[model samples]
Target: MNEVRHFWLGISCLIFKVSKTFRYVDTDNELEKQVGGYEHIVVRCPIKIVDENIVETVQKLPRGTIPGDFLDAIVVGMDMLIKKFGSSNKGKTHLCLITDAQYPIKEPYEGTKEDQVDIISQQMKAHGMKLDCIITIGKLSKAINQKILAENDHLLSQFSRKGVAKMRHVGTPTSLLGALRTRTISSVAIFKDEKVVQGSSEERLL
Candidate 1:
């Protein structure tokens, strides 16, 4: 059924802020209640899925690890989710990526982060997946935050500038409630197979 959905939610937390991320999600609130339908991947550089149980997964994340890059974690975790769950039929396979948009100072990944973003955006468009980021900004001014968000929107939209990618600002737990409430899964893109359509007669295959 179109109403039924599966979510691949990822948590990208910094070393010091890891507990806060868990606490926010672990709260007896709508977030926890709604997350039962999702298979969560916890990424703090090294990633693990607590499988179907969201609360237990949050509790089990190791503490005291060195701070790692959230961007790298998001890309890697998303890749895993897409490979494992992507499908051609929009009704059967609907993918949504939810993350807290907290970027670390230094990127731990070997390849260029831009390349990863570009590839991820392209794959998302091809597979018709939706991505939403609840941004948690610290110390940055309002002007800077807006600049970053706009840049991210452009980057994630690829060339099409479609509404498949979304971002929201959430500084505190209270703000996070609003962020969680705004995320609706009904807006997922419906995919069409281009390979089924042949080229025009004028086009020659050399």
Candidate 2:
């Protein structure tokens, strides 16, 4: 758990350095229960990144006491982004999902996990929000679900040809750091042209 939390904090700080706006959501099952339900995906911080305090706040976020459903979390995140930047052509908008692919879809979901992924991908396409994923490997557990990981990789590849999504599978903390740094530095150029272009670092991952 510490490994996962620290990796995420490092990514958040790196993003804070390069991004003008940042928002965070914790999909922890315990948190969801306390907040009333999974539907209430809380934004731990505001949309605007004012200063270093945002980084500090993110750093202090609690580690998940229980596993969370990434699919449900993705749905809520997509809805928030769609509401906030509906069809706007102003700035680049993206949702980066960092996970270990441990938790699969649980009960109470509207449809099958594949169906949810399809819906989420379509919503991302319609809203014009890029979906980037940093899928950490071997950090959480040895029993990581291969099925979920494969499904997630497929979803990550859904819009890669169009530069709508990018994914990195990192097996160590050092690699994770390098991936996040590379992403933060290259994101603007990647999204500015609306296509990753040939020979780019992101394209090599596809």
Candidate models: Cα lDDT each: 0.34, 0.44
Candidate 1, residues 122-186, lDDT tens digits: the string is: 66667655555444444544434565445554444442354445655545534533343221222
| Best candidate (score: lDDT) | 2
Top model by TM-score, which number? 2
Question: What tens digits encode model 2's per-residue C-alpha lDDT throughout 1-206?
Answer: 32552122111111211111122343322334545445323344323312334334444555544455455555545544444446552234555556665544455446665565666676767766666667777645556667865765665565465465677787875675455333322221111000211121322111
TM-score of 1: 0.44
**Which ranges in model 1 have alpha carbons more than 4 Å from their true place?**
1-65, 89-112, 138-163, 182-206
TM-scores for every predicted model: 0.44, 0.59
Report clashes for each candidate as comma-separated counts. 0, 0
Task: Estimate candidate 1's RMSD in Å.
Answer: 14.6
Query: Which pairs clash (backbone N, Cα, C closer than 3 Å) in model 1?
Result: none
Q: After superposition, how far is residue 185 of candidate 2 from its true place, in Å?
A: 11
- Poorest 10 consecutive residues by lDDT, candidate 2: 188-197
Cα-based lDDT at residue 192, candidate 1: 7
